[model samples]
Target: MVDPAQILASIKTHPPSCLQATKCSSHYFSVLSGSAKHYMMFSEKICWIGFCLVGSLTHVFATRYESGVLELGIHSLVPGHSITVDDDFVICDVDIEVSFSHGYSSPGDLDVGITFDADSPVTTGLARNHSCGLFGPVHARFDDSSSNTLAVNSNTCVSDGSDVKPDGDLSLFNGHSSQGSWTLSFNPSRGYIQLQQWAVILTPCDDGAGTGDPHFKTWAGKWYDFHGACDLVFLSNPSFAHGTGLDIHIRTKARYQYSFIESAAVRIGEDILEVGEYGGYLVNGISNADLEKLDKYTVTHEKINSKQDVFTIELGAGKQIVVQSFKDLVSVKTVGASLEEYGGSMGLLGEFGSGKWLSRNGTVMSDAIAFGNEWQVLEVEPKLFQTNQFPQHPVQCTMPSTSNVGRRRLGESIAEASAEKVCGHWGDLKDQCVYDVMATGDLELAQAGAF
Candidate 1:
């Protein structure tokens, strides 16, 4: 009873979390057709490099598991100071550190051991056997991938290197479940060890979006198209990642019988960033230059060499909003954390994790037009625009009728086979690409659609 369209839409919208590793190399990697440089920032750790524009389109993607630090904040060495990592990442690597004040004895006297899932100590005698005979408060680190030379203090004892190995090498934990308790224990044989703090670094999670025309995809992987020419709330997540607030509003304009996103205004925390067609940008209704002085977010814009320009807004905690523009057409995308981690998010994007369309009143909508109209930005919401445009809040969404659809359709002149060939490998977006190409009579729209 499964629908093939829904299956393809899910796969096209939200590919499996790349942390699965196997699916990462075989699938989920996106290849953009251009020699021009393109960067796909998965997190601070992952990056994608674009290759040549001629012949074939190839992409070189390099990624590493993102790490998150959990503070232990213990003043003294306790038997079982631990933290739980509940994310679904594979436990590829682990590093434990302990900082202590200079007591009556040498820092080497403070012996430390760490265990995972109540198992044997991954490493022991971090400070006791290997402090490099250094004085002052010692910052000792025991890494799972260090040289396990415990007989005598090696030169590495002065650094992050470790003199002990886990019962099995750190690699043994690779592909193992990341959801477990990591316990840090110290020997009390040398009396109490005064410590400043202790902490562990573990891997984390990621998710986001990319949409254009009137075609939409929620952060939760739902896909649909709404040809509504009006301003609407694309996403409103007050609890977006680590308490960072985000509200994105998009304005769409009618083109023939179809519609395309014209502009987008994103409010992250106190600052507002607005991007529109033709590469113009505004921050809090001010000039784009003000984005450099943004307090909470890091903003960057690519050089505007072509018609379509890309801009990125970095919301702390590895979350970002990417805006792309191409002369009267614009698209918005999200990166880093998934919407599910935000507790709940609303607007035209629909429910956080449910693929069902949702109304602002919590009603499960049956169609895209109904769901999209419910999210129309109300006059009460903060107006991030410089000036009010026609058909503002209170006005119903201007739904475009498909009666004149044939006017934009591929006529008998351009065969369906020819249109498909010109659209290239757009995956599930090929149909939309073909339609946009015929509607505008511009082949470049196909590339812009990809952007």
Candidate 2:
């Protein structure tokens, strides 16, 4: 629903150096990373969002939400650079890349530090009064999941500094809100450092769903597959703005020992949009023609060679749902502001923001089956779908007895090498991609993994 032409026109008004702003499928994010000094904008994988050079000492990056890595560049470093993260996920890891035109005589000459909100500056591995020398561009990574220790590219750099706090690395900011301003600072005591470009790669806790075989990557970045055939609540926020928030439900059908999402119904306020296989959709039990007149939402249907139907449902304000369907396989994704609004929400998608699977009784359900079954649409809840599919509310959701155990091993039918080759691009979901391809014997399902 984002108009590329309008975005391009806005970019033209900026200085010529900030000409390129890469827009991805979910939303528009502008950042720079990888081995190059310039922004490397990937088509489908990562998004290089908005870029700007406001003043000599400060650079501001306004980034929209979505899964994947976001790298924002700052050419200068004196006071610091401020990054406003509008994404839903919490900051789990942060990678800082600093490039100087020349090397420093000693690492202690320049003190690099970062601060989130009012928190104290976290020096990590970059600090002053150290015995190491800054030879070239350096990459410092702070990951909370792996270790409290900060990982740096240079062997000469010390892990801890004179002023390093106990929680110096990203562990200090882990589980904190990803929103608000993050300031990066560099204080040099000696000669001009001449920093060419410095970038921050922010990796948030992402959420996604693979339709066939029905693997779900929760908001907390945990992967689990549920093979339940029934109409279930995918995500629900009953208290969103006076109980008119988003209510999404999905219809699933059994396929061998697995299940595929047959359709999805999304309700926002008074409007309901139901999408199914093969480019079929209905708005409030009526034809799709009414979507054009709606003010709160916009829907776009792109059918490639009349084979696959990709629907992008854009709810006003940065919230969106992208549904990609190839043949009968369907995958759905919620990105940007959509995720921002669903903090502490419920359903099969798990707890929004925190990713804790909680039942209606507010009990944390660790088991995927219990979590999935806990969200089955209750009989009293309003039904959004027009047709009453089998195994509806009031009926216990049907599940495969074996639950993917001893079920044809991955790469058993499909060549292991070929499956890996096809699914390698899936990143963290690589194994899920291979499993979906092998489970359904459909190569196109792996292609839809991009959703």
Candidate 3:
């Protein structure tokens, strides 16, 4: 939204000025041919105000001595500015005033006509002439009693001697190149017509001729999980708002029986969190309480390419979430989970159906006790996880206690057995041995064996 106050301020700071002007014969004159051209400049390709044309005239020289003329012609060299002949130029809101000084002797025989050049492009290459009767020659007698006003292209002329018409069109001169030539020509019969005065207004187009502010680009489509394991799909339509700002909407659904979970979470600039259906927990200076206070997250900036965007997720608190986006994937670097939170002997663990974990500093843990057996602890440098770089495999690690650990996949019972052994090392610690069995019915317990 544009601030009206700002617009007013801009107007006050830089007032509008005439970009160009050209005038010929403001005083009454008798001439065979006359034309005026003006050059204009628009600061912006798309300007608010273009230009205007103003002039006035009156018909004369049709008395007993001089003898009335056949017709008077007015033409505009510009594609759309002809009054005498019908052309591509569309003219409206005519307010020309006409009056008779002397009475007419033969109003019907002596016709007063207005015509334009037939070569105008607006005529579609066809020269069409249009004329209307001004007054009857019989009623030509008038001193100061005969005067009239008519709108441009108005079929109805004022019956009263004096009148004025206010509505009309002048679009031809409104929205062309900011810098161009505009010429208006007038020809009168026997030097009888007199131009009084005229004025017109024009407005520019909205798009600013490709230089408008608040430019936008949009992308809308569907994406699928890389593995195709769970029929997981994402329908997203994201619109760019004011360069860095963004509005994103994504609908995620799972078609298969597998539970879909996110390994990371998105943060909406210290104000919101758009948690998916499967709720998760925040970490690293962010707490569940902080997440509760936040409004539903609406994206302000979308991650594009590998460029990292760090957003403050807790207003004023300074907590941030770093994110990177790829073709169909997003990598969030916040300490958060995309699944149910569970406390373990090492730290906390949030598990996804893809056997991935969101853990604190590589301290391995699992939502299910038996599930621990499926993963092997690996010793690698502690670096940020790149969603596109790593292979789809299970991994676990115990930090501080050891710098390097090798991972080995084992069977369900083998994992249970190993867990029991590790629990035994704690020497009858109740919580150490008694693990939470949160697995669903289908994964409760199958044939327990060694891997």
Q: lDDT: which candidate is best?
A: 2
Give the C-alpha lDDT of model 3.
0.23
How well is each residue in 184-242 modelled by candidate 2, as lDDT tens digits? 56665553333334444555656545465687767656778788888888888876545
Structure candidate 1, residue pairs in collision: 122-166
| Best first by lDDT, ranked | 2, 1, 3
Better of 1 and 2 by TM-score: 2
User: TM-score winner among the candidates?
Assistant: 2
Model 3 lDDT tens row, 1-451? 3343454456557664423221221222211121112111111111222211222221122112125542332222212222321112222111123232112122221123222233332111100121124442111111111243333433233343433322222222222222222223222122222222221221211110000000110010011122111111111012111122211112111212211122333322233243321232343234343434434332233322232222234323222333322222223322221111111111111212111222435433334322222221223311112222222223321111121112112212244454454444334331222121111111111211100
TM-score (C-alpha, index-matched) for candidate 1: 0.53
The segments of candidate 3 whose C-alpha lies over 4 angstroms from its true place after superposition are: 1-175, 185-192, 207-451
- Model 1 over residues 147-216: C-alpha lDDT tens digits? 6544332322343322344333443333244556655565533433333345555432223343556678
Runs off by more than 4 Å, candidate 2: 1-203, 241-243, 293-295, 316-318, 337-340, 403-417
Q: Estimate each model's TM-score.
A: 0.53, 0.56, 0.19
Question: How far does residue 222 in candidate 3 sit from its true spot (Å)?
Answer: 35
Q: At residue 139, give the lDDT of candidate 1.
A: 59
Number of clashes recorded per candidate: 1, 9, 36
- Model 2, position 32, has a per-residue lDDT of 38
Model 3: residue 74 alpha-carbon error in angstroms: 14
Candidate with better lDDT, 1 vs 3: 1
